[model samples]
Target: MLRAIAVAVLAIGIILVALVEAPIPAVALTAVTGVTILLLLWPRSSRDSVAPSAPEPPMADARAPIEAISDPLLIVAGSRVEQANAAARKLFGAHVVGEDVRVAIRHPAATDRLAARQATADQEPIELAGIGGRDNRWQMHVADLAGDRALVHLVDRSEGHAAERMRVDFVANASHELRTPLAAILGYVETLDDDAAAEAGTRKRFLRIIRDEAWRMQRLVEDLMSLSRIEAEKFRAPETAVDLAGLAKEVHATIRDAADPRSCDVAIAIDEGLPLVAGDRAQLSQLLHNLVGNAMKYGRPGTPVTIRASRGPGAMVRLSVEDQGDGIAPEHLPRLTERFYRVAPSRSRSLGGTGLGLAIVKHIVERHRGRLDIRSTPGEGTIVNALLPIAPLSSNRNATVTGPA
Candidate 1:
């Protein structure tokens, strides 16, 4: 009776573990566990007792729990794979069930731990790369089971590792970006305090340099903060209906009002009767400003930087900014949206770019559940397009927003 209770307890434990970790429903797990317990602890007839020498039923029953886990798990005994769950077979291969554990997991770190005759102080979770595929990463945890058996669980950590790496790289890049302008400001201030201040012209130039550096730093900080806010709210979609045509005109007016030389070259060609898009009004305004601003900065002087808005494929509203400038090389196109990535870092800095324009635009588009595309030819020019979804229950209306003649 005690033996039956132990078997019942084991079955219940497996089900509880599966309920916690596996994707299977709790009610389903409970029902399955009850059935499994009955089958494991039920009274055996004379014929079933005679078959006890055939195989160990209790141990075989334990395989159900192992298979319930989504992570790859293995039961290694005597340095050989005694049993492997479905996930393990899918990752290492179905043939790994009877293969040597060291051969099954090719990583040196995994091999060393799996091959150890006895538990040592060096036992810890092993990070294995290139296990399932190149760029794949897994955390291998080994727990010694009874009867010389080992339970090896592999959890995929590729995404978490990638996020951590991006975080580190972003910090380093931001520090360098901020440091450069700060160093410039400090050097200019020191020069102004010394012999350079004796000359009025030189002092003015030095002060101008300091002011520009300070403004650059200010812009960088603002962009960084904006990026953080956008990322924080990325998971929540904005449902506000935004009029694309009016936003385009507002951005154009703001650019023209600044009285910059490039403002004259800016052109707006928004389509008539364009529908409202589902987006945050402020973010969409910023997106337009970034795209159009990039165009004005990069496009050839006196050439048109056209901003066009019209209906797009499906339920999307297409907004594009076309610049007549030296187009980007194909190789640099893919990484353009990455923070601090620039085709010409020096030129970008000279034009007052914080290097976060496209990155912010990318995140903004992602938050709105839209698509962004950049097309360029080396000699012709580059065009950036953002397709945003039309707001539900919002239809096109007759509205006019025109740029300067």
Candidate 2:
């Protein structure tokens, strides 16, 4: 640019000397034009150097993607939360969006980790309790992002933890149930063996007791095996057609003698033209037996224990067992179907209940593509209703078998 300016100046001086013979106004105009040309033709970059840098393709808001994610996620800038996803809002609160992450999260370890400049990748995940309530459990994981930003992912572990606790409880309960009968049988056997002076009647009575205890233990083992098998085949939906009305009557008749109906009246009611349900016949029969047996055993003395079968909505069969007895409390209704759960442990044991009856019934109903509903009011009666899909008359009913997946 300097060389161009010098050449232009020399040319302008020669132009003025040549134009000295010309008018002074014309010479002045010519010099002005020359300077303008030199300046306009100056060397320069193609791009507009003065314009601001192409405004950063607007930092593609990562929070948008996190909003669509199912897991709870939070984006934090320093100690404050810049954004929270829908799940995060639900787990915490909508106000958490602009709050301090440590305060919003309400966890000592997690808050400390977030506050620290450095975080350990191998640090054990901090457990968050009572996210929604005391029954819930969640795990928090924090990861560093660019520019003092961090991402926190929350995983809910409530269901898994509850299932694990239930497993542990089931094993313990089964062990205790099995041990009771075994101990009774062992004690009676030893007594009979050591006492030679035991009278004939006494010996016979002790033998009866031993037999009863052995049968009780045997029943428990059988129920446990049955429960295991049912769970193994839980995913397998039953396909064979079984008449539920007939099964209900058969169960009532089978248990009529043992029901000791002096204090309870066992009755069966059937609605005509009931559709056949697609299910495992043996399991369905057992389900009916357990329900009716429970009804008869628990119904108040002289009150009617009714077993009814009728057509349900949408091509379904409704089989119900109702007992007029001291009803169960509202709290016990939810856990009644859980394995080894009994409302009255001692009463249940004396009545030869292994506490797996309702649980078995539940599995069988599930296998049949059915729904079971239990309703009871204190001092009134309890009703158990099982709704099962009617077997399709056409083919393709057994296209695929569902089993535990």
**Every candidate's lDDT:** 0.81, 0.76
List residue ranges in candidate 1 displaced over 4 A. Answer: 1-69, 82-86, 93-95, 116-124, 393-405
Give the 10-residue window scoring lowest on summed lDDT in candidate 2. Answer: 38-47
lDDT of 2 by residue, 1-405 (tens): 653774476366446735564324345334433432332332222123334443222223444445444567777777888878788998889899889887898877777777763555545567877778888888876666555666677777787778889899999999999899889889989999999799999999999999999999999999999989988777767778788788877777777766364323788899998878888889988888888779877888888888899988887889998998999999999999999888999999999999999999999887776899999998998999999888884124444443222
| Residue-level lDDT for 283 in candidate 2 | 91
Q: Please write out the lDDT profile of model 1 over residues 1-405, one tens digit for every residue.
A: 744665565566556665553343343334334434433343343235757565433346557666755668777777889888888999989899889888899888888877673657447788999998898889887766544666677878787788888999999999999999999999888777777437888888888899999999999999999999999878667878889899999898888888788998888998999999988999999998999889999999989999999999998999999998999999999999999999999999999999999999999998888899999998889999999989983322212212111
Model 1, global lDDT: 0.81
Candidate 2 versus the native: TM-score? 0.79
